[model samples]
Target: MSGSPLSALSWRKSSLSGPRDVCCVEIAFTGAATAVRDSKNPDSDALFFDERVWNRFLLAAKTGEFGPN
Candidate 1:
């Protein structure tokens, strides 16, 4: 993922973000992986996750596994 060109991917930010918002994460979906990068630093390396791991992480997030206890 790091070697490939991220500019080719269709990165998208959350719709909830306003025009003035600067702090947010952008995501791009690929055939084999999902890409995540900071909207404020688009040139930085993106985090890539395969389908299974990404889905698991999403489930955990939805279940508040990352929330404070």
Candidate 2:
């Protein structure tokens, strides 16, 4: 992590993001972690999650488990 390998990643936003939406999350994957960052602030530090945790979160999201919160 000392060399900032994340900065070299090719970050991508969701296809659903529209031209008018200034606030979106971009994601990049490394061998050890998944990185998420604000599309509006690419220079800011990104949040990293373990691959297993990221997959579980995606599954929950797809299932609508985080409703009304």
Over 1-69, each residue of candidate 2 has an lDDT whose tens digit, in order, gives: 436776799898999887965668999988789999998777889999998999999999999899853
10, model 1: CA deviation in Å? 0.5
List, residue by residue over 2-25, the lDDT tens digit for candidate 1. 456898999999897768657788
What are the per-model C-alpha RMSD values against the true structure?
A: 3.4, 3.1
Error of 2 at 41 (Å): 0.5
lDDT of each structure? Answer: 0.88, 0.87
Which residue runs of candidate 2 sit more than 4 Å off their true CA positions?
A: 1-4
Question: Which has the greatest lDDT?
Answer: 1
Give the per-residue Cα lDDT of candidate 1 at 13: 95
Number of clashing pairs per prediction, in order: 0, 0
Candidate 1 residue runs with Cα over 4 Å from true position: 1-4
